[model samples]
Target: MLIAPWFTITVLAGIMIAALLAIQRSGQSRYDSLVTELEQTRVALAQTKATCEERSEKKELEITVINASLNREIAERMQTEAHAKKLRKQFELILNSAGEGILGLDTDGNFIFVNTAAALMVGYEPTELIGRSHHELIHHSKPDGSPLHTGECLIQQAYRDGVVHSSSTDVFWTKDGASFPVEYVSTPITENGDIRGAVVVFRDLSAFEP
Candidate 1:
């Protein structure tokens, strides 16, 4: 019951050819799958790149807007400062032109400003009086060498009570410790319904007194 040698050879050759065909088909299938996967990956990468570019553009735009806003704020602040400086200079000139001695005080009785006439009358430079206590400089004592009480001083009361105080008998001292009679008016400076400080207008009575 042994098969013929030629038939056996033919059958074995056919099996070998079938196996080779199956392997080739499987390899081709795998190659097609890999190609599809690679195409998908490329598409995903392109989408990611587009999204990143869009976000980058938005960030750049935001930065540009912020810089523009900051620049505008700086410019406005500088302009306001310049205008304020100009106004201050004009105010100073007006005060310096007055004939009467003019003195400005802060809430704490410190000298904020003194015009040229005021400084000369007090025998001091304007720079010497600024920021100094007004009460301590020329009005600390009476002509009789007694210490003047803060509660009774008309000058102090002007700012404390937010009222106008005047006196013709009060005496003011010079830098060299000489005293002279003065007719003076002390007026409170009110702004926004609040008393901020005081302004003193005074004239030396030494020239007018007999």
Candidate 2:
């Protein structure tokens, strides 16, 4: 039998060892790829959670802003109502203290409100005149003694014209059957340039009545 050379045996052993090292390196490369993929998935999940949280916070802030706006509107409405009530009380005090007769009527000529002195002048209790019509209360007449509708009444005329005037031809009859000639001034009350009502102040002219 021929003997194998030592040099050939050494070369063959070196080739086998190199092949084994290449196989080990391939296994380690596969493990490294799996680790990189897991890390990327974790980063994606964290970004998604952060985005959801940001959206939720924005919605909460919007709700807070809306609630604040509604609160301000409610406060403004309450203040307006309070101011109107105060003005009405002050007006009533002045009306009751005045020596002259005063009256207020709505747009439809219905008595919406009145004062104590006005009731005393007409010979009725203040509560009794709250809903009464002017035609029911006033005995409107001409110099020639004619029944009158308020359409032709002088106080109404001044209200329509938005003019203030004083007159002596006016007369008001008390509930006690006493008729009085009167000198009076009538003025229109307007809001936003629209006629709301009129105020009439008067005194009896019985001393000079013929």
Top-scoring candidate (lDDT) = 1
- For each candidate, what is the lDDT? 0.69, 0.57
Q: Which residue ranges in model 1 land beyond 4 Å of their true spot?
A: 1-73
Residue-level lDDT tens digits of model 1 in 79-102: 655655565566667667766677
Global Cα lDDT for candidate 1: 0.69
Q: After superposition, how far is residue 113 of candidate 2 from its true place, in Å?
A: 3.9
| Candidate 2 lDDT, 92-204, residue by residue in tens | 66556655566665454555555575677778886777767665676456544566777777677655877765678767777876667777665565555666555566666
TM-scores of the models, in the order given: 0.65, 0.57
Q: Root-mean-square deviation of each candidate, in angstroms?
A: 42.2, 42.7
Angstrom error of the Cα, residue 47, model 1: value is: 33
